[model samples]
Target chain A: MKFSVVVFPGSNCDDDAFQAVRSGLGQPVSFVWHGSEDLENADAVILPGGFSYGDYLRTGAIARFSPVMSAVKRFAAGGGLVLGICNGFQILLETGLLPGAMLCNSNLRFICRPVHLRVENASLPFTRSTRVGQVLTIPIAHAEGNYFADERTLAELQRQGRIVFRYCALGGEVTPETNPNGSIDSIAGIANEEGNVIGMMPHPERASDARLGSTDGLYIFRSLLDWFEQMRNAECGVRSQAAVPHSALRTPHSK
Target chain B: MKAKVFVALKRTVLDPQGKTILAALRDLGYADVADVRQGKFFEIGLSDGLGAEQARQQIERIARDVLTNPVIEEFSYQVEP
Candidate 1:
């Protein structure tokens, strides 16, 4: 599967995402500049983390107007897969691809550390490689990572199982002390209603390599590849309920 | 024409920076200080081609769609002739 990593002007993690897909996941990947209006046949798009537009006007306010975002929005509307990490998650929220908004961390300090995340929904394409309630150690680095949504939206997300990941302890306990950014409901990540778009504060790319002390992040990239493989087999009329159920693959844009 | 916009976190949202400032103020012996809510201010200059009504509309749009994230923040703006 081919991946396109969107690179905004201030995107510092583009290379990290590229490397994760290319070397870690062993998939073909390319960097799509923010000014580009096309995704260039990308099977999946990734918005990597960084302070785009110097984070001026707001964390993602300026970057949301980038030319590439329109293309991304269209791709998502078409049911194409999109994974947003860190500041990319902020961009996704600002673009309305995902619900809710981000606020400054409750402690008023920039947090940079490896935090544990519990997979809340493994049936989705993004978390198919993990199990429900499984804890993975992933690093989170940001100041405005506190996720916020209204009570109604929160209840809706909960009801739909769209809350994909939550900050948790090593033992898989969700607690206030374990929430690094004070995100509402301990949310570390979430998926859109269609299940194709995912936005998360954790830096999965940064954790994809063993040399980086943890390869737990590789599961997310692997899950995408797994999804693509399952899609390809389905296209060939080969029924394989090996891992993900055929019913779970509701991705309409898979080709 | 010119416009001024002020943006602030909604009442339901928590403002850690504002709370920290409030603590500092109280520490300084300002017993009457009730609260401190941080906000952002912006001054925008309009181009010559726009009329008064047009400028007001444009500024309102800018403040609504750009200056504030309606999910968590709100804005108030003033246009000067």
Candidate 2:
């Protein structure tokens, strides 16, 4: 399967995302410039993390009005896989691709550290390879990681099991101390109502290779490749299925 | 004419920077210092016909969607003619 990583003017993590995908999934990938009007023939799209436009006029605010975002929005609407990491998550929220908004970190600092996160709902296409409460060590680098949703929407997220990832401790519960960003209910990542679009705060690409430190991120990218393969064999199209009725999503990369 | 729009987070909303400043003031021996709230100011150039009422509604749109987050910040706009 092929992937496209979006690179905005201030995006510093596109190259890292490309390397992670190539090494983790052993697949073809390319960096799509933010000014590009098309996403090319990519099965999945990744909005990498960075302070685009130097975070002018609010982080992700100007980027949401970028030319490429319109295409990105269309891709996600067409059921194509879309993933936003860290600042990319902020962009997704600004674009309204994902439900909810991100405010400044509770402590109002740019947090950069490895944090534990649990797989809250593995039934989605993104987390199908894990069990609920499955913890993975991933690094989060952002100043706006505090996710906020109204009471009703938050409850709906809890009810639908769309709340995909929650901040956790290495071997303990996620209390206020463990919740570095003070996100409501410690939400680290979440999927849209359709589940194909996922916006997460942690940098999975940073954790994909063991040589780098942890291989926990390998599962999520591997899961995307598996999903593409499944679709190739089933209907031979470029759309993703939101529902994955299985536990521990894993399918060997059928090159 | 020129109109300046000042949008600020309400007092009830939490302002980390303002809190830090307030704390520093307390430690500096300023005992009577009250609360502090941070905000953003914009200078918008409007035509002569754009009065305060019309500008207020438009400024509110920018506040809710761009200038501030309604969930945490309450946006109040004042148009200086």
Candidate 3:
């Protein structure tokens, strides 16, 4: 499936994501400028990590209003696949594509280290390559990766199993110290109820390369490919369900 | 017209930066400091004809879409009339 990565003004990881999917997987990929309106026939749209607008007004704050975000929002609304990593996750939060927000890391520093993330929902396109509880080592480089949702929303998310990833220690439960960021319930990633869009604070693309000492993130890319391919086939087939919007799939209370 | 938007993390959500600042304040002998919550401030200068309501709406739009993460932070603003 064709893929496109968005490049915001200060986006620094678009190249890495492009290389990982295009060169690493030998797949067709292109970069779409933040001001562009085209999705370029891409089956998947990824907002790669990096400080967009220098993370000045809040990590994803300024980037969310970029010209391209409106298009991305439209695409996601149309049930197209979307993934936001790190600062991209912040952007998704800003765009309201994904609910919730990120806060300063618990340590109050730019944490740049390998963190152990446990897969909680392998059934989703973002984590299908691994089983629930599978441990993946990926690096998180950000000052604000801590996730927070209100008590009622948190309960709803828990009840819905929307919680997808959690910071965990090797062979241990996710705890305060093990939670790299002060994410509630150690949340690292979450998907909208429909699961077409995902936002995660960890850089899965960074870990997709085996030479990076961890190929754990490759499964995510593979899962995304499989998901898009399936959706493409479904669209061509007799299924009238392909065009439903993600916003329509949100909780009835959500506007 | 201009407005300074102050966005701060919710009390329920931990604020490491604010906490660090609080710690520094307490350590530096500011004993009366009750609490500290780190936040962001944005100075938005609008058109000359911008009314307070119009400006608030515009600023809130930016806040919802950018200036603040609604899940964790709440934003307030003051107008410079």
Ranking by TM-score: 1, 2, 3
Candidate maximizing TM-score: 1
- Range of the 10 consecutive residues with the lowest summed lDDT in candidate 3 chain B: B63-72
Better of 1 and 2 by DockQ: 1
What is the DockQ score of candidate 1, to 2 decimals?
Answer: 0.89
Better-scoring candidate (DockQ), 1 or 3: 1
Per residue, candidate 2 scores C-alpha lDDT tens digits across A96-173 of 888777777878899999999988888787887777778999899999898888778799999988899998888747
State the DockQ of every prediction: 0.89, 0.47, 0.71
Report the C-alpha lDDT of model 3 over A9-88, residue by residue, as the tens digit. Answer: 78888888887786565567778888788877767899999889898767878887788898898888888889898988
Better of 1 and 3 by lDDT: 1
Poorly placed runs, candidate 3 (over 4 Å):
A231-255, B46-66
Candidate 3 at residue B41, lDDT?
78
Clashing pairs in 2: A128-A249, A129-A249
After superposition, the stretches of candidate 2 with alpha carbons farther than 4 Å from their true spots are A236-255, B10-13, B48-58
lDDT score at residue B1, model 3, on the 0-100 scale: 90
